[model samples]
Target: MWELIQSNRRKSLILFFGMGALLILIGYVFGSYYDPEAGGVVGVFFAIVLWVILSALSYFAGSKILLAVSGAKEVTKDVHPQLYNVVEEMKIAAGVPFFPKIYIIDDPAPNAFATGVKPENSAIAVTSGLLSTLNRYELQGVVAHEMSHIVNRDILLMTFAGVMLGVITIMSDIFFRGMYFGGGSRYRSRSSSKSSGQAQVIVMILAIILAILGPVLAQLFYFAISRKREYLADASAARLTRYPEGLANALEKIANSTHKLRSANKVTAPMYIVNPLKREGMKLADLTSTHPPISERIKILRALQQGVSYNDYQRVFEMIHGKKEKIIPDSVLKESIAVTPVIGLTNEDKDFNPIEARREANDAVMKLNDYNFINCKCGVKIKIPPDYNKPIVVCPRCGTRHQLR
Candidate 1:
């Protein structure tokens, strides 16, 4: 598993640097096509600047941006202590320095994701639906999956890659728009230098092709990397929780769920534990798909009988497929040991009720939106709508008149 992680890190670094270099090349070609004198150098410099700016944004403000886009609100432990406690437990299991902040989205879609530049800066956000749908142990399984992502350094790599993909998309759009608007004049500029005309035309042609296909290639690579990491995270989650069935059950629920996450988009969808926007007929090994098939994932988790380790998962994967594909590094497999199974949840977890959590999440969202709560003397709590115009209110249960104002 450690070797697998190292391999992932190495591949990620290569992809990041490779994509960055491509962006720089695109910038140079773009600049040279227009100005033959210093345009190429200026373009490279500009690309570097843009890359730096985007990387910084992804590192510093990326989590905040994602939270805001997902309509996630930071939740306090006092509000959702059960969720907080689960996160803390997983944090300890992952051996992170501190507990990642927790956020809740108002959407009823049963999905969750983790994000940040590093473990110390990480955060986990889950939909209100997830809280309402999953029991204590099930929720722990999901949280553990996300914790594994953070501890495994998938967050940083994915976030940076996503940002780089964004840059490529933007640059591609700009190039195409420039071509559509005034490409002929730019091409004619090359005629000013006869000695370099052929070279200039070749560079321009390559630039156009790259700009056209850069985003597509980058996105394909991004999805491929993301899918690989998802498998790794699943194995790590099972290892951390020592209860493979819990996560398997959770995955089943998530996969069968019909609710679509409203806040999910193409860019953010890959960050989720499962693809929030799934298409019909998508297979586990689809190169274009951002996640492995949920059925396949659940199968892998359920097949683990020996213990929750990478070697166990690999063995099951190969057995289930009747193939000898290696998912874990050879070095890690030889050194792998059995992990103790987690028998069950603690007392606090046993006390967690999904129904109550759903009600609590609903009430929290309502309160945040200016709904007023009134505890009546007749053992009934009434929620008053924010826009209610009447001055008086009566408890439906007790017929007691209350002042609305």
Candidate 2:
């Protein structure tokens, strides 16, 4: 695991520097369109400053922003006992130093993601749809997958990459709009000679080309990195849970689902277990996909016939993908960590009903919104919405009065 983290950090640094170089180059290109001599230098400076600020935000406050944008509400173990319990089990199995805070998204899409700068300070969020859809074993698999991302530092890497993509998109948009409104008009007219004017035209053409292609190229980089890490996380999940079928089945359910995540954006798509934007039968994502093909992933998981170790996952992964390169390093294999026994479900997991699951998810969300609950003597529970401004509520079933305040 330490080797994986070290390798991940090394690769992350490369990715950040690579994207940052693109950012600076794009800045310089656009700047030259305005001030051919000095604007390029100014643009380089500006790009550096922008990258620094975004990196800072991404490290410190990015998770909060992502959760807010996704409409995630933090909750206690009481919201869904089995979910908490399963998460707890996986946390122990993975040996995460601290319990990741739990969050619930209100969307009905059955997808989940993890977020933090590191594993020690992290949170995992799932949709209400996931709660209602997945069985206990499947839920554990999804949790383990996200937990793998935390342990692998995939969240941090993806966060930085997403921010880079965002910066590129923003810069490209500004460049296009500037061109559309004749922003570079002063360039040619200010040229002192015909050669200088030609150079300006070339610079303008180059700027336009970059503006058109920057985001596309950046996305290719972003998605390429995203797709690879999903495989790693999937492998890690299998190793942690020692139950490949659980994640395989869970992925099947998620992939076959027709509902696209309502709150998902391009930046957040990579964080989800599956591609959040695409539904079944959409354009098959090639290199630009955030996650690997769900079918391929499920196949690799189910193909782990040898064993449930990292070596086993790598063996099957290569056998399926037909690659000689190793996904699991030789050092990781040497650890020779034996698979731990699987954690059996508790009575709470056994007794879980889909209808009850949905209700529990809804109640958890409402609690976040300040909804009040009261139990009546007649064995009826009263749920009062947050906007219920009245001071008292009468239970419909028991005709009992409950104080709101």
Candidates' C-alpha lDDT: 0.82, 0.84
TM-score of model 2 vs. true structure: 0.86
lDDT of 1 by residue, 60-133 (tens): 89899999999988877755677889999988886667688888888888999998877777899988888887
- Tens digits of per-residue lDDT, candidate 2, 143-171, equal 99999999988988988888888888888
State the TM-score for model 1.
Answer: 0.84
**Model 1 alpha-carbon drift over 4 Å, by segment:** 1-8, 185-195, 321-326, 329-335, 340-354, 363-405
Q: Model 1, clash count?
A: 0
Q: In candidate 1, what residue range of length 10 has the lowest lDDT sum?
A: 340-349
**What TM-score would every model get versus the actual structure?**
0.84, 0.86
Superposed by TM-score, candidate 2 places the C-alpha of residue 276 at a distance from the truth, in angstroms, of 1.7
Residue 279 deviation, candidate 1, in Å?
A: 3.3
